[model samples]
Target: MKVACTEKSQILGSKVAKTLGLPLVYSQFKAFPDGELYLKTGALDGETLLVSSTADNQSLVQLLLMIDACDRSEITLVLPYMGYARQDKRFNDGEPISSRAVARALSAGVSRVITINIHEPSVLSHFRAPAIDITLAPEMARWVASLGCDEPIILAPDKGAVIFASEIAKHGGWEYDHLSKTRLSGEEVRIAPSSVDAKGRDIVITDDIISTGGTLATAAGMLKDGGARSVHAACVHGVFASGGFARLAAAGLASIAASDTIESAASSYTAAGMIAEAMRE
Candidate 1:
């Protein structure tokens, strides 16, 4: 088996390659002055694992090109962060199931697919090939445990994230609970149970993604108001879109940490080992 990676995921791909004891294949990528992309990879054969994170349209396009380049090789597509996964269903009439569309596009020329901490696990059903969804929750939990907080509490910003919080708490051996959120409008939200007694206790908010960071900011503020000693945030994918990290910091979070799924400044953990293990299985 051999390992290859797209430009954006090179760091993580190298880590995974090391873990798998596989030779890493390098690909050349270039953008024309007209804004078109070009990719070049050596002759691909045998079992080849292509690692990429579809974090944006450019990355997705590049990945598609790379997959097409691997002629006749058994391709194992590894998407550390699958974009458009949140839109797994058509919410209204005339709406596209974006996740399914993306999955269809990605399934082309691939034998199997693997993703880490994808937003909707159900999205795997959209793929024609066998798809595997892995989680970085345990790795994130280990990072939290290394923080060495004397009195720590794991908090989920919303009920949907309670499972993530529970995973962290379980691994870290701490108490955990989720906050209730009432969205009044796009910019306005109400977070509760407003009565968490976090006084003098370190709080860690765990979630799958931190896209806009509005929910996390609101939750952090509420925790601060509730007298938490300090607030930290962790997630599997840190999209940090539109100044999201700054917003979370401004909301009084002491620190923000995330896995290397998206390759952001907040990426303090690596899920390469986890993905490598899944590939072995």
Candidate 2:
């Protein structure tokens, strides 16, 4: 199998290729004067692992183009971060199921698909081809353990993320719990954990995706108010959509860390090894 990666995931792709003892294929990408994307791939045959993180519309287009360029090759897409996954359901009339649409588009050119810590696992059902959802919680836990905090505790921003928190805690052998969240608005939320007694404990809030960071900010503030010694945040996909990193910093979080799914400054760990192992399976 050969490995090829979109520009956004070059760093991670190289790592995965090295682990699998596969050669990394080079692809050229550029943009026209009017901002249209152009992509060309080198020779690829047999089973090929195409690694890409659809962080935005442009990267999605790039992946599609690359898939089309790899003529007749069996393509297995590795989407470290599947964008538009949050819109998996129709909340109102006339709303589009964005995740399904994206899945269909992706399935059109790939034999199988793999994603890391998608917002909704149900979204994988939309793909016509076989789809796999991999978790980065173990990688996150390993990174957290490297921090070497005296009294580390893993916290989920809301009940929905309890499983993720628990996985990290289990891997790190730390205490784990979840917060109750009340969404006041798109950019506002109220988070609390009945009685964590966070006093003097170093807390790490873990989640699958951190978009606006509102939930993390609120939870971190609450922990600090409860006398927590320090609060940090970790996630698989750190979208940081609207100044989220700044918002978390303003909320007094000691640091923000995430997997290299989106290639941001907060990416303290790489999901390459995990993805490589999944591909082997």
TM-score between model 2 and native: 0.94
**Which digits, one per residue and each the tens of the lDDT, describe model 1 over residues 95-209?**
9999999999999999999989888899999998999899898898888888888858888877787887887788867888887867889998667543466777898988899
For residue 267, model 1's alpha carbon misses the true position, in angstroms, by: 0.9
Clashes of each: 0, 0
lDDT (CA) per prediction: 0.88, 0.88
Clashing pairs in 2: none
User: Which digits, one per residue and each the tens of the lDDT, describe model 2 over residues 2-84?
Assistant: 99999999988998999889999988899999999998888898889999999999999998898888768999999999989
Distance from true location, Cα of 11 in model 2, Å: 1.2
Every model's TM-score: 0.94, 0.94
